[model samples]
Target: MKQNPTPAPIKINGSNIDLGEALPRKIQDELAHVAETYFGHLNHATVGFTRDGNWYCCTINVQVSNLKVIIAESSATDCHKAFDQSLAKVGRQLLRRKQRVADSRRVQMSAAALA
Candidate 1:
């Protein structure tokens, strides 16, 4: 059976609103819960929040076990929207990473089987 490792503490950087001011108990709890859901799937990650003009920007840099490094950035009028977009981007990255690993293993196995 595979055991999922505990998720590390989340660090947030925000513009306009201070970290405490921007996230209330409910919001902070929700963020932590969602982050933990991904747990061992992501080795390490950094999330940052900023704003420009009328847009809120969120950027996440993550390293998955099989994928060296992946970056996802999105802009929205709200922080939650930005997070949603960024998560979507990361999901795509995960799929690509998994596919690449599968392909590589297939090639290696084929070579070994032939030998």
Candidate 2:
């Protein structure tokens, strides 16, 4: 008898490549946890945190099973707020995209029936 293969665990990779003080280690761990818990069975994740003077920016690229998701950078004078807002933006985009894919499928099926 052949054994079934289990799905691979998601991969999360983050770096404070430019601004260490702007993003604390605790926040980095939290970001990884949130992504694993909520991001549509993500296959891979890449995150970068940076700062411009007092402003902090967080950027994340999340890959799901079937889509490539790019989130715009989110910035604020407060580091925690900037990080939270960036993740929230990604969540909102996922919701909107889910609706769009469903709508497109409906249209395609309707057009096919008319043929």
Candidate 3:
């Protein structure tokens, strides 16, 4: 049986709206899923929601390691939409980071072989 590790605690902050039950749970699950999918481990995460005029803003901060932090923010008319957009951005950022690390290792190995 594959043991499932406990997800890292997520801190949520919002302004001018009741977060309600479903939204928080959804956010927690989605964020944890995304973090695990990209980074394999999540150190910590913080999600913030704010309203600016008609737009709802969502900001997600994910710490995959002690020194590395990824932040993505988006605004939409609905909170859910904002969260989705921000989450997409975070996914892209994490993918890029993972690719960069892979590329660097490949380059080092190739150079070593050449020498």
TM-score of each model, paired residue for residue: 0.75, 0.62, 0.89
Q: Pairing residues by index, what is the TM-score of model 1?
A: 0.75
Q: Please identify which of the two predictions, 1 or 3, would achieve the higher lDDT against the true structure.
A: 3
How do these models rank on lDDT, best leading?
A: 3, 1, 2
True-structure lDDT of candidate 3: 0.88
Cα lDDT listed for each candidate: 0.67, 0.62, 0.88
Error of 1 at 4 (Å): 5.8
Leading candidate by lDDT: 3
Stretches of candidate 1 above 4 Å error? Answer: 1-4, 18-40
lDDT of 3 by residue, 1-115 (tens): 5424877879999887777887899999998888788767788899999999999999999998553889999999998999999999999998899888889999999999999
User: What clash pairs does model 1 have?
Assistant: none
Model 3 off-target regions past 4 Å? Answer: 1-4
Q: Which window of 10 residues has the lowest lDDT sum in candidate 3?
A: 1-10
* Candidate 1 whole-model C-alpha lDDT, 0 to 1: 0.67
Clashes of each: 0, 0, 0
Which pairs clash inside model 2?
Answer: none
